[model samples]
Target: MRDINVSTEAHILEAAFAVFSQNPGASLADVAKHAGVGRATLHRHFAGRDDLIVALTLTAAQELDEAVETATAHCQTYTHALEVALGAILPLAARHMFLATEPAINDPRVAEVYASQTRDLTHDIDMAKAEGAFDPHVPTEWIVQAYDNLIYAGWAMVAAGDATPKQAAALAWRTLTQGTGNDAPSARNPWHPH
Candidate 1:
């Protein structure tokens, strides 16, 4: 409706994601101002707020698909793959965490992408078990669930300001690989070295 240039839509979407991530109830005018575009321009691209939300969800899913592919591209060890995958996905997860509360986030179209990601995670866990990276007795599904939980929890910690993104990633990797148990045979305790 107003200045809807073909090149500006990407800018509008990126601004919308930034706005919505902070304030899910943000108005289209808020998005437009943040995008440095006219309200009508945003409206022309997205008829209403719901349309914009759906578009954001789709964008996040697509980005996540690419991130996963890039993280696993080199066929490293399963633990390394998991570490890189978490590093790649954490920022996206922070942006899209709002999707967890939106009913439309479960749209079948986006669900397909999420399902593919899940399958990839499951396959990686299987590989980890086969390679003795994970405890062989742990079920693949349980490990997959723990991995998913850690990703969510890591982002949650970041959102809460309890940890920086770097610290969160390190915490997730350490917790996943070495649990809280004090079973390691070090001459001195790692947690309380004296």
Candidate 2:
């Protein structure tokens, strides 16, 4: 009986991700249809849409925590860890990206998780800066924001079928380390006056 409850809940969450990722405005009925569960069963697992969103947000946060830990576990440098984390996280975009602008994220529980994630990533960025992997002159907060936005961009590329997750991750890494500029000495910034 417990197993069945857990299975149904998991199925509903999975369907929520699928339906919500494609359309943030999708209703609980859409999730029920996608999961092949009756509306009653869906409501039994989650009282309402906000409840479901919170569940999904918490689930995504837990998954991200695990991915970051596993990805960085064997890394010798924070930079490499960041790259590896990007690889691990890009595939989870469907589970998380939709929540970026969702009001449910303002829930205290979700905010706490997000705060912890920010602190962890900030520490990693500081460590990478110490290793000269990142510019010490730049604000750590800015770097953190850039890193997060890059992840979003990479995920968008993958979601749009413009690139595979691997390709998107590599592009994100390069964009982080190297701006979109010609490296040749003769190449000059057109916007800058000499």
Candidate 3:
């Protein structure tokens, strides 16, 4: 009985992520339809939209924490760590990107987790700069914001069928490290002088 309830709850959460991610204004009925569960089932698990959003936010936070931990583990260089982290995180865009602009983020529980994650990410950015993996001249806060925006862009590309998740991750890493420039002598660009 407990196992069945757990499965049902997970299904509902997955449906909620899909529905809410695409349409933040989607109703609980939409989630119920997506999950193939009745409206009562969703309400049984989540008392209201706020309750469901909180659950999703917490789940996303836990997934992100795990991804960062796994990416940092066994990586010899900060560059590699960042790449691995991007690869791990880009796929989760659909699951968490909505939280970026969601009012639910202002919730105390969501804010606490996000604050901790930011602190950890800031520490990693500082270490990356010290190790010469990231530009030392750039502000750490700017780098953090850029990293986040890049993740969103990568997700958008993937969502739009412009690139696979792996391709998007690679492109994001390249854009971050190399910028959008062609230094080849044959390349035609006003910015480049022969």
Candidate 4:
């Protein structure tokens, strides 16, 4: 009985993620219908729509946190770390994009999740700079923002069925590490010798 209830709750949360990602203003009944659960059952797990959105946001933060940890563990270089993390997060990117646009997403708990990521990104940027893998003059924040924007763009491509997740991640990595400019070894080259 307990296992079934737990499973039902999990189902509802996942359903909410899908429905809300497509439409943030979707109601609890929409989630309940999507989950194939009665309204009563949905309410039993989440008091209301706001409660469910919060749960979804927290779930996204938790998933991102776990992905970062996993990527960190398996990565040697900072580029590898960022690539792995981008791959880890590609699936959740859309849901997060939706949740982040919500007003209530400013919750400090969510901020902490992003703050932790910022710290990891800062560490990786410093490490990459030390190894001469990234241009020293580029601000860490700009690189992070560029990486983040690419992740979202990659997610959009995947969501539109334009590319597989792996392909999208690869493209994002390539675009970030190598721009469309001339490949001549000059100041424009990311790998230009310092």
> Would you list the C-alpha lDDT of every candidate in the order shown?
0.76, 0.83, 0.81, 0.77
By lDDT: ranked, best first: 2, 3, 4, 1
Point out the higher-scoring one by TM-score: 2 or 4.
2
lDDT of 2 by residue, 62-87 (tens): 99889878877999998789889988
- Candidate 3 CA-lDDT value: 0.81
After best superposition, candidate 3 residue 72: deviation in angstroms? 3.8
lDDT of 1 by residue, 22-129 (tens): 987888999999999998878888898778877787888788778878877996687678778878877675688776666564567767766787898899878766
Candidate 1 ranges beyond 4 A from true positions: 1-5, 179-194
Model 3 Cα displacement at 153 (Å)?
Answer: 0.8
Error of 3 at 157 (Å): 0.7
Model 2, residue 39: distance off in Å is 1.6
Arrange candidates, best TM-score first: 2, 3, 4, 1
Scored by lDDT, the top model is 2
> In model 4, which range of ten residues has the least summed lDDT?
179-188
Off by over 4 Å in 4: 1-7, 22-25, 93-97, 179-194
The per-residue C-alpha lDDT of model 4 at residue 118 equals 77
TM-score on alpha carbons, each prediction: 0.78, 0.85, 0.81, 0.78
